[model samples]
Target: MKSDVIADWAARPGRHIVNLSGGKDSTALAIFLHDKIPQIEYVFCDTHKELPETYDYLDRLEAFLQRPIIRLNAQRGFDHWLNMYGGMLPSAQVRWCTRKLKIEPFEAFVGDDTVWSYIGIRADEGRSGYISTKPNVHPVYPFKELGMTIADIERILETSGLGLPAYYSWRQRSGCFFCFFQRTGEWVGLKEHHPDLFEEAKKYETERGGEHFYWRQRESLAELEQPERIAQIKREHALRLEQERKKRPNRPLIELLGAVLDAEDDERGCDICHL
Candidate 1:
């Protein structure tokens, strides 16, 4: 059934687009379909708040694809949207960021044209892709149709020479530097690696009089960065990593880190931003 849908889309005459999220799966998907879909358009929704490493990775990918990966920017960036929503930082519950920064720009890019949006969701994963509600936009998952998994994605990247983004060593996924969906350990990683960006994230948590808006629902970035808190988060993460190693001794450290982080907080991230 999946193969039939994929085949049908391949034969259909329309615009083909692959939205790159600067993550491994999407990067692999771009490499996977580069030759197969010659007319396929690759695009990245720039939040302008993305990590430097993300931008660098995209630049490398553009070189590999030998075509420009169109960068779609929200008319206004994160700070502008943050103010529009009364300084309330976007959280998992109220993710205006994804809607405004990612989906809207993507929709505007496609306009009314019939589009087949290539999503990099793998067959081993059960999560759904972010299919736009726009009637003209259709979502297609080649990885799922081909039954490709993490190992296949790794192979694709390795062969392409693009490899994974530098941030993958500490942070498993790529979105924003201060994405609330991040685990405690990832937050620590951000603070350690990008203190300036971490400080900027801290500034978002304002306590004007009595009203408080924090990136993390439980604690502010300032509090999270405290020595004791950072130590505790690292210790807990290390314990989980050891446990995962016992269970899957042959698993790569990066994969194990992702699994441990997921176990710590299994909240599904915004597919548009994280995929």
Candidate 2:
């Protein structure tokens, strides 16, 4: 869609919505389009299992927008869906969590209305996030329309004084703390930064029928948490960082780390959760 398309959609008053993920890109988009669209409805689909930093960042964003970011939640949260899955935690291959917990609630909230759902996907990115299959709900990418890229998004957040979620210090994407998409280094960061939350995530992985159900397939959180395993993950991450740095000597180490980690992502997870 072009910038004029979004502007035209904003000119009408049916329903103008922006779904906030408490992630950098989404939050930056919210601020970028704040005054551009009239009566824009901001929303967040809470999974009830997000990191504390995510919640805090959302609250701060609400204050910045001076408008309520409607928080949508599944009628029944993670526990209910987990029970329906027969005690099996959601994995990338069989990701029932994003559908039931995030997308379903957001779609239901829109109902059958003609909704112009403004997404934060940038012009430089080439991937689609969650789009409702409902005929009435139309997906619009204002960031892409405006030719905004990651550098543009960073400027948007920087100018708004909401640079990035504090979680960026350790983790990259904002989603469920126990999201299986997380890398080994991110898990280690979680264990070091938030030990209690790490333990809670570990509790989610359980043994059933002599087979362990883990967020990440083939490896339980218990095994991942061992001192030796954590050290090995860190060592591998450091080597990867060094390799990336050698390739792009001028790039900042932080940006290099993000790129290297992103390269390792198998791209099997839902954009709804990660976006």
Candidate 3:
């Protein structure tokens, strides 16, 4: 991650873009690079299924940067694709949602252009963000290149006055409210914080031709919302937090919450969609 490499990308004589997910990492990346790359373009692929807080966070980021964030929307939209695929909801295994709603719109926007796509993955993160297959689209990692971690990201947001999204108080990842990657506790959080949206997510659970489809594996939102089930999830989450606190005391609650969620399931959420 040489400084000259980054400078070379900056002077590539093409589009320089940062894709925002309305989450902390990508938001922090945008703020960090606001002054560095004057020609940088910020874009967000709107699936029309994101949480209300994510949309609000983007508006604030736009105002802070003093630049317009180009929002790309798919022509056919989510519902059309869902119906075309026989109502099978997108899962980690079959991420048609990411393809149709997120990646496709982004690739279309940078058609045949030698674009430098700035990704927000931290150095601590083991996975890479979504890299387009298009030869013209080159991926760049500023935070990773600088060896920044979660603490560094938090400091950037705090200094910029754009702290974590409001939903981070409950849900950690920022994507569709009904993202299939959601853990039991996040599902409970969605129900508690945004009940109407929670209800909307529940409507998608269906038994199509005797094949049950739910956001959470082996559990439907209706089942997860049961008072007893929610209590159990809260109890388990509390125990995890208690254990994590013993290892690292005086850490931020948001950081603690994110660690606890990751311990529940090691499967990293979508890099691009949940950045």
Clashes per candidate, residues 3 or more apart or on different chains: 0, 0, 0
Question: Model 3 TM-score?
Answer: 0.95
Q: What TM-score quantifies how close candidate 1 is to the native fold?
A: 0.95
Error of 1 at 264 (Å): 1.9
Off by over 4 Å in 1: 1-8
For 29-83, candidate 2 gives per-residue lDDT tens digits of 7897788885889999888888999999999999999999998874677888899
TM-score of each: 0.95, 0.94, 0.95
Off by over 4 Å in 3: 1-6
Question: Each model's C-alpha lDDT?
Answer: 0.89, 0.83, 0.88
lDDT tens digits, residue span 97-205, model 1: 9999999999999999999999999999988879889999988889888788999999999999989889998898789998998887889989999999999888878
Q: Candidate 2: give the clashing pairs.
A: none
Question: Which window of 10 residues has the lowest lDDT sum in candidate 1?
Answer: 1-10
